[model samples]
Structure formats: structure tokens, C-alpha cells
Target: MSQPSQRPEFPVHLLSSPAMIEACRERDFARIFTLARRAGMHNSLIARLCDMTASRVGEVISGTRQLRDMAVIERVSDGLRIPGHMLGLARRDWESASADPTAPTVDIAPAASGLVPTLPGADLDSILAVAAGPKLSPSTVRALHSSIEDYWRRDDEHGGEVLRPAVVGQLRYVVDLIKETGEGEYRRNLYGVAAELARLTGWTYFDARQYSQARTYFTEALHLAKAVDDRPFMANVLACMSLQATYEERPADAVALSTAAQDCARRQGATPRVMSMLSMREAFAHASMSNRSAAHSALAEAHTCFERISDQDPDPAWVSYFDETKLIVDTGIARGRLGEAEAAEPLVEEALRREPRGNHRGRAFHSFWLARIQLQRGNLDQACDTAASSLELASVVESERVSGHLREFHQQLAPFRKEPAAVAFETQLRATLR
Candidate 1:
């Protein structure tokens, strides 16, 4: 067998105290490994410290995997001497206490918003200097933007729970860099990245059901986007807030926000993709408010805008995910909310078919909507089967939004409790819950 290739060495001085603490707090193994490598620690040494195989460490460093499991986080924390709050875990003794049969279960909340509390400028400068060491170059700033974009892609595939901490940590790091130095194009780019990152962080919090924190981040994102005059991104953030309002059943608030987003997009001459997305949210708000005529008109406008989109359009990176498939899905969902089951069914089915298998959360969400349509049509057996399938997919994902769908589906099945299929689904769902 061929011998394994040796890893290159990094300088230990590069792993600053701030970076290490932030990485540990976020439970970001990839960042920690990178910092360690820069600090001249070899893969084998890192593996030994974290009590894992070198290959496993490599996988994390490459962003191919994450450290989301609590037991693994605890183990790593213990081995690395990381603080408890940083890992969002209970005291170290809590694990040992679990060995006792009567030990109380520990209920640790997920890490807080990860927004560093503001300090006086002088104090902050001193603190960040210790962590960041030196001013970042334009190349380093570009790399950071690339990393944020990567986090966005990963969030699409894995759901918020898995990537929120790391993204927030990145946001914190970027904010620190902004405080350090930059001007002209460099300053503009940094502000734009920070705004986008804030929006993304808010989106993750929304998905995780932390509504208050989500709103706070979204508000801050809008402010930052406005500060940089990034109208398109600001519009996107407004649409995101609108979606959250719709989810919370605040139709008036949703309509107001979506309408604002539409106005912003139009003023900025945003790409058709952006306009389409804003229009779709507006349609959703109208539907929620039971204004059928307004909803249908908005949906038509959304379709018109979507049709105008081409590969050559100047789409922003933040709105790149808004393609035909997404438009179709949202249109179907808007119709479904308006009680147009016949109109919604085929659209949702098509969306489900077009959705890639790797998009587990998307598949689950679309499947649940399909099940709702089936139920609306009085096809209890079909509805039960479809919902069971959705629940199965939801079981494997860590998303509060998907769980909410499952709960709503269960409530819909209550009217058919006497049916064997309904009873069977209830059993399976209960088991999944446990």
C-alpha cells in the first residue's frame, strides 16, 4: 500500500485567543482545526486532542461534516478544555450525573443569537486586537465572503440547527474585521457581506423557531444593508421578514412588509428573480388575508416576472436560489392557504418531483402541503399515506418548521381518528416523536 501523504505545518502564533474562544463557543470544529493547523499543530495532534481519527478531523476541516451531536460536543469540550457556555451545554457534571438512575434531565437551550454584546469602542478595539491580531487584506475579505456563501449553500441542504452557530461565528468575526480597517471598495464589500450574513443568521433563527431573535437580526440586517446602499439585499431581507409574519399568521404585517419589498425591488431595478420572489410573498400575504382576487393577481404578476428571468440576468448571490421550482412551490402554497385545493395539488406535486433528494427539508415541506391538499379533497387514505411519508422525511431533519408542518398534519387527521389509516399514521407519528 502507498504511504499516506504528510500534512504541512502551520505557525502556532496565528491561532489567536479570540479565534479559539469563538470557535469553541460555536462548537465549530472546522474553524478550530484550521486555527490549530495555523498554530503549527498537526492533524495527528489535533485528532489526539479531540479524541478522534485523523480522517474525521480532516472531514470537519473540509466542511464535509459537522459536530452537532451533544455527546460528541461534550467529549470534544472536555478534551479541549472548552468552556461550558461556549458549547451551549450543561455543566460537565451533568453528564456524570446521568449515570445515576434518578438523575434529572438537563435542558440546555441552543446557543444564544451569537451576537456579541456591544462594548465601548476602546475596550472592543483592545479585545479584537488580541483575537484578530492584524488588519485583514482585501483577499482575506474576499475569502470570508466566499465562506459566507458556502454557509448559505450548506444551510439550504442541512437546515438551520446544524449551521447556525458557525455562520453566526463568521458574522461576529467579520464585524470585528470591519472595526479594524477598510475603505472605498473594500469597505463597501465588507459591509455588504456583513449585511448578507446578518440576514442569513436571521433566516436560520426563523427556521429554528426563535422568532424574537430572528426579528432582531432581520432588523439589524436591514439597517446594515441600507447603510451600504445595497437595495436589492435590503429588499430580500424585507421579503424574509414578510415570510416570517405570514408564518405567524400576521397577514397585515406580512402584506405591509411584502409590499415594501416590492417597492424597493422596483426602485432598484432588481433582477426578475428578486421581483418574482417579492411578488410571491405578497401573494401569500393576500391569500392569508382571504383576499382571493388580490392573491390571484399577485400570483399572476409573480409568474410574469419569473418568466422574464434568464441565465444572463444580473441576479444577486442572495437571490440565486429563487428559480422556477421555488416559484412553483410558493405559488402552490399560496393557493393552498386560500383553500384552492384543486389548483394547488398538481403544482405542489410537480414541485415535489422537481425537488432534489438531497433537499430533505424542502421535500418534507412540499410533501406536507400535498398531504393537506389530499385531506381537503376528502381523500383520507391518500392524505394519511402522504403525511406519513412527509413525517418520515421530517424525522431525519432538524427543522422546527418541518416539525410544525407535521403537527398541523396531525391536527388535520383528528377528524378521521376512526379510520384505520389515520390511526396507523398517528401511531407512526407518535413513535417518531418519542
Candidate 2:
């Protein structure tokens, strides 16, 4: 295998940290095998856990096969009950790098607006009035929450459309309860509910490329979460903020927010899933900064932590959707950063395969990353197609981060502006900008 240093033409964006790679090399192989034995998993089980053939694990243990891919690193972490973050970093160090030599160069042009119609002043007033109405029941508030979630799901799949007036009416009912109840345990729950809604709205707005509005909701949600003194939920708000930071190419800011979230989750006694999420955000920040070592290290650690999750402890309600499969999606994204599209593709594909319907947001992300992979592979037409699909899926939602990805994709496709597919995608994407 060619070491990272052996390739002078390698894209700096895909380089892993040399220090992190060396750390992985320094780990005692005998020690891992011993730990696996103690975990009660036979060699065959270990192989399966690592996504390798039966003999592969044996060779790895016997100094034949190398511990390289995130999958294999994850298996070792699982077999030894090691922390996922540690393993992820190691894997990052070992994976190969890839780049889009054929990617069309975009000019980083100024962003445009006017995707969805802005709600009129009178309509806004009416919605706010309904939201602050008297006598709204908890059941009603809960129902509104469910409705927003459903709308978000629909937007994710079919594309962006304003929530129906009826849905807005229901949201108004919930807001009324929060305003009237005015602070207590009941109000705290209501705030939590509202915080969740606002966060999702902000995410959707971000998707629609309404960056300013997305920030407004995020700030409001952060305040509400703080009032409720809900640390776990606060972590989510911080993650949203981190997403915005990443979008702005403020990698250092992203790293700080992600680290803060990790600390908050740790302080709140968060579960493995929560920790994994915090770690994943940190890895994303690292990747954006071209800090190959930190990115891989964070990924390895996340993978290890994920493997150790217990079925016994019920996960926190907000983070219940995070599972092994989602972790794989995160891993794939990290791998793509380290210039290993070939390795990253399969993991991303597997994550999508396992992802359930209504995960419109996740599908959008999968397609977005896949487009980047296509670009790297010199498949310009396919890349453009994937980007168009991603934009269509993403436009209806309120996520700045997703919209940022679209912006980046557009930039990557700039060089191919003469191509009909590229031009069409640009036209459709411009139409969706709010």
C-alpha cells in the first residue's frame, strides 16, 4: 500500500494526520486480540463485526491484514469494548485519499434569494395570534409537534412547500399554550416542545437557503432550551449552531461549538448515542479544516463508542434516531474528507439502505455526499444529477447546513456551466433559494 507521504500530487484536503496514523501503528496488536478474547466473541464473530471475511480478522490479528477501513476499526472497538472515537481516528489515519480532479470549478459566486414566498405581514400576525390563543391543551401542543415533524418529513421527500394553513394554525395553538402557561414544569415541557419545533424549523430554513431566518430560530431555540435548563437539548441547539458555523467555513468556530456540546452531553450524563453525535460534529469540523488527523481520530472514537451502546438503557427522546447505521453515515462523510471515496461510497450506500422512509433529510444528505463522490470519480453528469436531486429534496426544509452543501455543490459544478445538465440544475437551484 502507498503511504500518504509517497504521493506528492495528493490533494491536501484528503490528507489524514500523520501523527494520528502513527498512533494507530503503535497500538499493540496482541493487546487487542487479548481484549477480544475476553469479550467472548470468537474469531468468526469478530470478522463479522468488522465487515470482513472470517479469515480477514484472523489475518489482522496475526499481522497479515491491516486495520484500515472504518468498518474494521469499528469491529476491533466492538470486540474489545474500546471507545469508538479512538478507533475512528486510527482508521482515518489509514484510509486512502481521493479528490475530484474532474470537478467543475465554481466561482464561489454571491448567493441568490427568493425560493419560497415570504409569509405576508397580516398572515404572520394571524398565525402568531392563533399560536398565542387561550386554552390550548397539552394534547393539542403535542399534536402540533407531530404535525411539524410530518411536514418536515414531507418536505424532505417531495420538496419544499409552505406548511398548509391548517398546520400553521396548529402551531399557533401550541405557542399560545407556552405563552399563557408562563413558566413551570408544564411550561418547561412546553418550552422543550417549542425548542424542538424551532430547531427543526431552523434546520428547514437553512435547507431553503434562508440563512438569516435560520439563525433567528436557532438563537430563539437556544434561549428556550436554556430557560428550561435542559442540557441534552442544549447540546442539540449547539449542534445546530455548529452546523451553521461549518456552512460559513468557520471551521474553528464549528470545532468550539461541537466541543462545547460534547462537554454538555457529558455533564448531563448523556448516552453513547449523544456522545457519538457530539463526536461526529467535531469530526465534521476537523474535516472542514483539513486537519486529517483530528477528523479521523474523532471518527474512530465515534465508531468505538457506538459499538458499546447498551440495549437496556432507553435513549433520550431527542436523540433516539441515532443508531449504528447513522454512525456509518457520519463515518462515510469523514472518509470522503480524507480522500477515500472508494471506501466511503459503500458505507454511505449501506447507511441509506438501512435508513427508513420519512428520513427525507438523511436521504438528501446521502445524495449530496454521493454527488461529491461522483465528482471525484470524474462522472460529471451523474454528479450533476445527484446534486439536483439533493437540492430538490433539501429546498423545502429549513436547514442552513444542507443549503450550504448545495452551495458548495454548485461551486464544484461551476466549471461545467456549459453542460446542459449543469445549467438546468443551477436554474432549478436558484429558483428554490429563499
Top lDDT prediction, candidate number: 1
Task: Estimate the lDDT of model 2.
Answer: 0.64
Superposition error at 312 for model 1 (Å): 2.4
The pairs that clash in candidate 1 are 12-39, 25-86
What lDDT score belongs to each candidate, Candidate 1 first? 0.75, 0.64
The regions of model 2 sitting more than 4 angstroms off are: 1-123, 128-133, 136-141, 158-161, 164-172, 182-184, 357-361, 379-434
lDDT of 1: 0.75
TM-score of each: 0.70, 0.61
The TM-score obtained by model 2 is: 0.61
Weakest lDDT window of 10 consecutive positions for candidate 1:
119-128
Q: Can you write out model 2's per-residue Cα lDDT over 1-434, one digit (the tens) per residue?
A: 96675311222322233533344345444445534545465677655555567776677677775543233454454443343233322112122222222111211112122111121111122443443346546676566667666766665565432543333333344454565575456766766776776676666545544445456667767766776677888898898788778776689999999999888878878888788888898898899888999998889878777877888765766676678788888888878877778888788878878888666667878889988987887888888888888787786554445666777788888789899988988898889853
